[model samples]
Target chain A: MMSAKQADRLATAGLYAVAGVILALLAGLLGYVFVKGFPMLSWQFITSPPQIFKGGGGVGPQLFNSFYLLVLTLVFSLPVALGAGIYLAEYAKDNWLTRSIRISVEVLSSLPSIVVGLFGFLFFVIYMGWGFSIISGALALSVFNLPLLVRVVEQSIQSVPRTQREAGWALGFSKWETITNIVLPAALPGLITGIILAAGRVFGEAAALIYTAGMSTPALDFTDWNPLSPVSPLNPFRPAETMAVHIWKINGEGIMPDASAISDGAAALLILSILLFNLSARFVGRFVFKKMSAS
Target chain B: MQTVAVPSRVLSSQTHVTALTGPELTRPKLETDRLSVFYGDHQAVSDVCLTFKKNTVTALIGPSGCGKSTFLRALNRMNDSIEGCRMAGEIRYDGIELQSRQVNVLEVRKQIGMVFQRPVPFAKSIYKNVAYGPIRHGVKKKKELDRIVEDSLRKAALWDEVKDFLHQSALRLSGGQQQRLCIARALAMQPDVLLLDEPASALDPVSTAKIEELIGQLKKEITIIIVTHNMQQARRISDETAYFYMGRMVEHGPTEQIFSNPRSEQTRQYISGQIG
Candidate 1:
């Protein structure tokens, strides 16, 4: 029995309240990160490797390792994720087998990151005997990312109009060709967004990497650059320390004396990297989606 | 609605004669013999027999749910994509049984294309949209693709409007131009049969006229089967017309005969704007 004005006021109030809360939370987190860590963010702190029992610790090696791992994880996950998504969205009939796979993916998506870490530890670390390697950790992270990528990509593919598929077929294109030429390109934005989000999740991950990728920092060695060579510096099987692990190691074990400052610096750097990644992804997405919609 | 009963002797004898004659009538580009389609257990089209002569326009006219669209889709085996939908009897193209197990749906589609009620341009540049089919069938040379795109667009009569913006997205075109772009995309594949399921249904008057004109011109090059609710359109563009009622072919013959002197009372009522 509320009046029209009253109902409108109530709806407006509810929306404003929700927006306020979201804005407040984001502002609070950003403010805290900047305030606590800005003082310690020096050139040397950014460029130099962490030294044990020292006041000043930089994340130079950790930053490099994060990028390397991100690239490797994308390489492993992109093709498989996109391929599985295409099959599910375009080829797979809505039969019992497809239904089961969909259910399994839903289950995997909901499973906690820590559970994935535990599984990685059991399989990659203990069973496979790939003790504390970057490759192993990347593989584990790729598994974590796979289900997400598939769901996002499948949804994107589904969002593409059936008319487009019909148009392609009408043009005498095969199913595979139609998918590649018409459907995939149209769904590219959603696919890229999924990948970027997965990359962010992988970049920020600590618990899983701690188990699979070991906590030992490596010295820069240009000569041993082969990624697959067991003895090479780039070999993922070689123990590598990332930023998240560096922060955890510093704060928990007190390997670095001024743990508070170093942890804050690492946290700020992690936040910055994630923000940068997301911003770039958004920029690319805007361009691609605009072009797609225009076409 | 007036119901004139046809003697069973004529019906039975014609069916028997067609069955015995085999493929002697120099199989038209597309032919459907006693073709019926079912959705689950419910029949959508029943005992519909028709033939589309090569390089001629054949129109299927009916009220809503009479299965004209369903029959058009059956020609290209597009109905196979629908769940719980099945077809009975035979559809032959150039003396080959289309429903045979060995018939590749993809290859069949390559020869027989479709244009839907609404224009469905791919979310790609004008150039890419036309080039998509050609590229897929192993036309790798960019120059060749460019030539095909131009030729197809020209054939579709869209080249004059969109030639300068070939790189622009297809979606930016006006409705009529987009429909023409879709026609060009189909023409690029050089399909022998073009099935249009109310190609002008969603268009404005001008666009509809353009599409109707395109259909008239296209019939000279490829066999066309169109389903339309618009009687004027059927009369204007079709060489042959098949009128359907309650899933049955009421009458089918030369367009002039069906429109001017339909033997069936159902077709007469339908054309005179009485009972649907």
Candidate 2:
């Protein structure tokens, strides 16, 4: 019995309401977390080492570990992911072997982070005898990050216009040359975005690092820059716990008086770091795209 | 500079053949012998035998899906990149068998460059786009590259318009300028032949005229083979025109003869705007 115009208006209003509800839920959650956590943030709280039995501890080492692990994970995963992505997008034949490879990537990506953590613990920690070190943790996160990076790279390479490839061919460029000189440059923006997104995931990762990287940090000598030295912060063999793991640990074992406050501050910092990653991704992507695509 | 006997079809009275020894016969630049192209099971071009002379323009005119573009791509082995696309028969350039699998495709492409319908500029400066071919071929000196780029751009009739902005990204150019840049890119290789697949069909009238005029000047050096949808463009630019339909070349002769004389019913009807 409703007129067409009235029905259209009702549908539009319903859609808007649904969208608004989703937006409000996200905003409300972010607002609640920021209100509870922001007060604990300060230069002192961010720069000092944590205390085991007292209040007023900082997350300096854990924050450093988080970034170092993120960098190490990227170093381990990027080349292999880029190669696999290029093979899938540019050269892989539509056969059973390629199909199985693609399916494996999909299945690996969907595996639970906890499951990957357990696998890392069994293989890298016990079997490989890495002793729950930064290397082990980075290897675990690499496994977690590879599939997403591969998919991102593949989609980015495929999204470049076919005409560009044809132009390369017309100008006497071989397939590999064209891919390297033309396609890769054109796909740089998408590749950078994918890398940043993967970095964000790696930065916030907790479950995998807990089992593979261990839940404890050896005392790190900030001035000892030698990577071979056991106590050096740069040593990959030393046990290191990240900020996310720190937050989780503080929440579970509140031995310190300000454990809740430490957890609150760490959680806020983690979220803010992720927000920074996303913002930088957009900035870098746009800058590279403009530099490559226009004068 | 060597003469090959003309094909029987070219000698037949049905084509309104007036000159038995035309320039296409005495100074052939490229010749195809029973060339057929297939995309998987579907035949895109069938039994196409044609000859192009040095320093002249030959236009391939046909309706959409008539395989002119396919035929053009076959000359430089561009069809080799397309999945399931294959070809039969022989393509010869200067008495060398270009269609043989043993032939170096990169060298073939270097000697015979191609320009496509849509303007495709690389994600680089205008100067780099033109200079890329020479650089890849091992032209390392900066002075040599600058000279080559300038010469190629001037040859393509784009030098004056883009001289001051050589460092600008080629993608920033207008569509017509982009097409001209592609031409300059191909010219940088200094190829003996240039294959254009409707190079101006996407441009405005003024741009189209500019391209046509450029083509007229270019034919004096490189043998030019162009595929075009516009009848007027074919008539104006080409020395010889070949009409194709349903993947087959129907009629081919002097441009004026093919346009003015009644050789085949299909050619007449198509030219007169009856059937496309």
Index of the highest-DockQ prediction: 2
lDDT of 2 by residue, A210-270 (tens): 9999888888888999999999989999999999999989899869999998998889888
Q: For model 1, what fraction of the real interface contacts is kept?
A: 0.54
Off by over 4 Å in 2: A293-295, B1-27
Model 2 over residues B11-82: C-alpha lDDT tens digits? 112222223234544747888889999999999999998989889899999889999999999999999999
Per-residue error (Å), model 2, residue B29: 0.8
**A217 in model 1: Cα distance from truth in Å?**
1.4
TM-score of 1: 0.90
Q: What docking grade does candidate 1 earn?
A: acceptable
- Residue B168 error for model 1, in Å? 1.9
Superposed Cα deviation of residue A181, candidate 1 (Å): 2.7
Minimum summed lDDT over a 10-residue window in model 2 chain B is located at B8-17
Report the TM-score of candidate 1, chain A only: 0.91
lDDT of 2 at B124: 87
